[model samples]
Target: MFQKVLIWFLLSAFFLTAWPVSAYLPSDPLYSEQSYLAYINIPQAWDIAQGAGVTVAILDSGVDINHPDLKFNIWKNSKEISGDGLDNDDNGYIDDTSGWDFVDSDNDPSPVASPEYSQLSISHGTALAGLIGSVANNGLGLAGIAFNSKIMPLRILQSDGEGLVETLVEAINYAVKNGADIINLSLVGFEYNVALENAVRQANQSGVLIVAAAGNAESDQSAKDLNIEPAYPACYGNNSGDNLVVAVSSLAVSGQKSAFSNYGADCIDLSALGEDISSLAYYNPAQGLNNYYSYNWYGTSFSTAIVSGVAALAKSKNLSLDASDLTILLKSGAENIDALNPDFKGKLGTGRIDALKVLNSSLPATGKLIKLNQSSAVYYLDSEKIRHLFPNQNIFFSWYNGTWKDQTVEIVSQEKFDSFKIGQNVIIRPGTKLVKFQNSGRLYAVSFNGLLHNADSLTLTELYGDYDSRVVTIQNSFESDYTRGEKLSGLTYPDGSLIQYDNSDKIWYLEAGQKRELTDDSLVLNGFRSEYIIKNVNSDFYYNIGRPIKNLESNIFTYFLTK
Candidate 1:
């Protein structure tokens, strides 16, 4: 009888034969664990997020809702029906009690038992879910950073860890609509699609915070060597909007970027824990384990989820903060990693997301201005100094001699002002001493000059900088004494042709063999060109002289010349 009972207990404990019992248990007290969380400052983060009521939405494979460590924190759609074969909430998903599974086209996303460990990778989704918001201080398993926050699992990817763009889009929409304060996207692909970009935009407009993995390709993802390249969503969404997206990188144990993680000056916005990370794994019924708890994988994907959880924590504290404002706060709260690498200073954003700093710091009403450049029009604040702007704020500026001129000359074509040459300017009212000021519902001083110009003919050098510094000039002009109003016809070059306009008519006419007229009016014939068109002329036209014209037509006419 004793032998029979022991056998029964063993059979019950080991749900599946393939589940590795040794890996699920915590490392021996005598041995130091080789995991990412072992090095992270979780205690500090806990102090801040313990009370914050943040809710993170994980859009991956479905989470194991019954997992002991995750059951208490899993978000449920109380309005939706469960297993009734009915769409009670009318949210388009049927019985999505926990989260929808796009791969199976059903709500039941329980992990399946597999003989091989590799075959059991579908457990990744559940593992990630546990890492983001597992029940904390339960004395059962490792604790997540934000232990008390809610975890909304939206399964979009399949068991193979691959998903379609359409499904991902739907998942994103659903997450935002379901009151997910922060959306975590741990999957990435090597495709650039407009549809996906629009989905991200829609999420942003809904004030949903999105954090994406920068991908695992080691080399610079932004390099031109990768043909037809561009990792989807993450690379495409960074800096796409103020509150839409943030691309994150991964830091290894040595404080260096992960070898498998992709990095680019323009692609990734920040770095976080990526290597040797520990998280929950699916229970392998084949190993006869009743519960699943394994931590053996590491990737930038996990880092992104942690950041998402932190963002959720912030949201719980201040529900009124917008996406942009929240992003600023998160970035500002990061702790600097390795004070020696100045090169990585701004490269890693404000630093790794620090939960305590974020929770304790005063919420600034001001927003941040990222990627500020001269091309950005400064109608309000024109100075080089950074200025804060509040919502619904307006910036006012006094008209200067070299400022406030129309940068675009033509209505249809894109003929822009030549920074090298003096262009048109406008004047302001009397006693309106040229003063540059920025307003975010309030006035603030900036680095712009307030000199009054004699006329609207402001030179690019004065307004911005040297014309040549803006873009390389390419010249494509055919000599002909064409009269004003007489459309210059039949001028074509290779696909990319740089044509300079010197006439006052502000129009370049294109005529094809007396059959078709292709006039390029108001030609600011500098910079790069991919296509060509003829339209009305304007004052902002420029001429380039040293570039190859991709497409050309034999018969061409020049309507006006400045000489």
Candidate 2:
């Protein structure tokens, strides 16, 4: 027997509306009407992060891959070449350059156009995609919650908004194997299947977060108690005891649970805007509408998508965040809405989500400074997720500018603070200042990853014009701590040195014992600073330099220098 899947809420017909435009606001006409943006403090959250370098897999009907607002944000598979008719990546799928369409077992994941389903019903995934990651500030369409995140579309549901649990299991596994940081399941069913639960458990074990919709009430029937009639994957989280999934209910503009949203504190883990929401519309050729905007769409599906977008933002802010960390931070940062809805008190898990609060509750990313609440000790989390403490204020200041109270140091809870294992004490930042022993007057420059390079008198003048003020004295007992590298007598500079010659306008990256010129201008525009670049370098320094690197587009170099 086929289990009939429910789309979960009421949707209004496609319509056009206008709003007055102003400076500093999105030029998209619908942006003015999206009051939920301010309700969730999305602007404040964007101040911290715009969800870059994160991927959210949408397992829904299908997404319009060519939609103007979503095309640029679609996740691209770098390993597989398109139209090759072969599995280049050798991951069992052929020519899935963007994402797989499990419903049709094809490469294109766009919604299936059929006469069996209404246009409004088939447009489900595209609307959710818009809510999650439409291009922001592009003056074309409404902005998404995590505007910079990539959307990985995995088509599991069909045009009529119904699909098999077996297909969903395959999509979940595919999402995990393809590097999805978060999985969004906006469809709901009442049947409990073991295969689906196992897929969710496997995804959770792989550090991928799952966000699912709490089933909605029928028009003739009242909202059901999830504790008695629990939904499948949403209720699985309640039973897992580890918050393996984020089961979301719907909230109206009044901050109360939507009349159609399923309730019961046991299943619903969060709430978000689900009424009068607007997003991108599917292009239905049968209707000859050729439209691209939908207004007044209400559903637990959209609410789940909203939460998924915020989760993406949280993951982007701290790349080290696991599924458990995300669930904890989301719950801890939520604003309790029990006061607003007394009858539904405790029924709405953790009340409504606040994007800014969620980000504030998260730990800082690797290579940043962090401290535990109520403690003054600061630690630097490295790329390996190891925390290294600074022995003294002198040592701490050498690696950071300004003061500890600045945004450079993030305050985290005791649980988050203890997650990283303790490593060796933090060494001084490379290429910033020269160091000298207490007994020996000889000065040495710190290179990449703590290698000490001898800076002789002539080398000192060439590297730093004012060498006296840049030298930092260290205790004789600490002399053995540093690893001594090659002297500055060679034509090559230290590993972390930034050099620019008087004759060229090129900026060179010196790292990993090689010099590669950055070919992509956007990398420099993203975070590379000009102040750190050493200008008017001696011409002799360029003779033995490594060959220029072509098409260098990765942000690793920029992140290394900026951090």
Candidate 3:
């Protein structure tokens, strides 16, 4: 009798093996250990929306697209004919059937595994992808929050988890152009980058939501005050009501602020369970790449993925919801945990996210992309009931693929179009296409607020990692129509590109947008392999480079390692 009771308890209680009546309960072996799923109320949320018909762009270290739990949900570029060695989609990237790898500038976006690097750093993107959209209830490793959502793995960070702002900017544009409903940036940097800021702003304007980590605290420090020391992408629109970047911070299992989570009332827009999280594992040095599970991972990076998954749920429920609509719904549905963390009260954004609450809430009915009386003018009806016009065909095509007559755009009466107040005119989508004056020799990249930044040959190659094959030569009279921003001068090497002098033993880290020589030991410490470095470059390039950064002993090169 005792043995039977013990067997029954083991099977029915902990693992829930005996009962399969509950449709929500997953049979994955590791499902019981994924405590954060319950902490964020994902099981209940799943009943409403399983994240169908939504695409999430994971802009981090590349994901393991072949992972059994992830393979089915990996997004495919239907427009691009594979292995053709041509830009079939004409969207800058070639043969990006699954996703683009900005790190190596190739078609394969899978993480580059090396025996030299840490498994955690290399598997970062795969883990985040699993958290967002791994196959659910398949008796696999574990269920993802948005199991039915497709994942577009845009590899921005290298295998070591280090990446540059320029790469991030280009990736953001790619996500927006490729129809990513939500872009999950499970990465962070200490510096402010204008190109990255403009990229985020432009993506938000294009009806895509961006979710960024609020950065973890340094090794020797407590949680830093973001108000005093800001982190990029997350703090892009701080204190601005129009800010659409959903800056997510970290919370522990106890409902308290994770000691390492960067926080401030100004920057943090949401918080989620960052401690003791579980997800799929990719890098296994001993056994090689295999479908596996990992637990106890903690960071605002995972927290950001959590919120992004919830946002995916929201997007799946209401196909027309834009960035602003999702942000408002998330905030309104959050469960305030300030009472638990008295010291960090009001610093944790609206509060810990309640996925069920976010899903249950209704979005404003005014959201849509529409045209008037079969007229060529296209406008986006925003949450505030404002109609923002797409100034020209260039701007319209930048936001959408195919022609303007797609089913996504609603044909409304002129009176309905005029019902909403006119807001700002839509700007050309960034990083999708290049523009230039018809008679001018120079080429310019479009950014937020219609700002054009002049790009030279080196800027095109180093910053965008490609040449100008898709330049749109506009009429010279249109020059006055755009706001001119800064020019991309070749003062610094593209951020994160490796360089060495013609015959010098020294290697420089250009991630700071300037030349900073890496210590000989850093090569081994950070897993700087030979193939990744651009060797034998002329020494003359370093003539205008900035001095090496100070306090190298404390700074970790990557965010995943720091966390």
- Top-scoring candidate (lDDT): 2
Which pairs of residues clash in candidate 3, taking residues 3 or more apart in a chain or in different chains?
none
RMSD of each: 18.0, 17.4, 22.6
Better of 1 and 3 by lDDT: 3
Greater lDDT among 1 and 2 belongs to: 2
Tell me the TM-score of each prediction against the true structure. Answer: 0.58, 0.65, 0.63
Cα lDDT of all candidates, in order? 0.50, 0.78, 0.74
Model 1 RMSD to the real structure? 18.0
Q: List, residue by residue over 271-292, the lDDT tens digit for candidate 1.
A: 7777655566665455554455
Candidate 2's error at 396, in angstroms?
A: 34
Q: Please give the range of 10 consecutive residues that has the lowest summed lDDT in model 1.
A: 2-11
What ranking emerges by TM-score with the best candidate at the front? Answer: 2, 3, 1
Model 2: residues >4 Å from true position, as ranges? 1-4, 17-25, 284-289, 363-563
**How accurate locally is residue 48 in candidate 3, as Cα lDDT from 0 to 100?**
96
Look at candidate 2 and tell me the lDDT of residue 440.
Answer: 90
The best candidate by TM-score is 2
What's the lDDT for residue 396 in model 1? 16
lDDT score for residue 129 of model 1: 79
What is the Cα-based TM-score of model 3?
A: 0.63
